[model samples]
Target: MTTPRLTPHAYVLAVPDLTRTTAYFEHVLGFSRLWNDGDNWQALGRDGVRVMLGRCPDAIPPAELGDHSYFAYVEVSDLDGFHAEIAAKGALLGFPPRDQPWGRREMAVATPDGHRMMFANPIRA
Candidate 1:
């Protein structure tokens, strides 16, 4: 049987401050701003991983923060290295890398606005 192929395009996040969020992605994650389509809509990140920040009038609605749902899992060649980088850069929530039962080595972190971003690498038997 052939496993179905899948690809991710983008993720939408509601932020109180677009400028702050954009700057965080750039200065910390090394993401370059692709474009800002006015009013709170900003496209960011690179290489197929894009993060969209939308301005919210009040604090982010409860619906946006679904059941601990993560936007995406970014695969990096060096999770341990990135972990150290983010830690040094003062990521909101940084942790050491660990191998999980699901068969992946990962390190999870969150932005100041509470957006959880995870970097991981597939574990091979």
Candidate 2:
């Protein structure tokens, strides 16, 4: 028997305001506007990475707002270059890229709705 291959298609994020969130992803993160339902759903992509933004007022409960309720960790091919580009675009970077003990170089940023997004690449030996 052979194991089947699985791949990540997209990430759906619950946002309170789809329009604003969509714009952030497009302008700040350099994601191209793919499509939208014109109501509550929008999709964005960049370099094979796709993210779906859905309007959901109750997505993050009030109580969870104080804590890390949602986060996405994406693997990138050029972590340093990507980080520099994002910074040049004036995105609010949570932190600069740092090498982790887990053998990944990672950087983090927070969305307007407070969702944490982390971009990482395997550290080369």
Best by lDDT: 2
Error of 2 at 21 (Å): 0.5
Cα error, candidate 2, residue 13 (Å): 0.8
| Local accuracy of candidate 1 as per-residue lDDT tens digits, 11-109 | 888888788878888877777888888976888976778888888759764336864646667899878777787678777654678999999998877
Give each model a TM-score: 0.80, 0.86
> Which residue segments of model 2 deviate by more than 4 Å?
61-67
Worst 10 residues of 2 by lDDT: 61-70
Tens digits of per-residue lDDT for model 2, 10-112: 8888888888888889998999988889878998999888999889986764235655644678889999999999899888787989999989999988787
Q: What's the lDDT for candidate 1? A: 0.78
lDDT of 2 at 30: 96
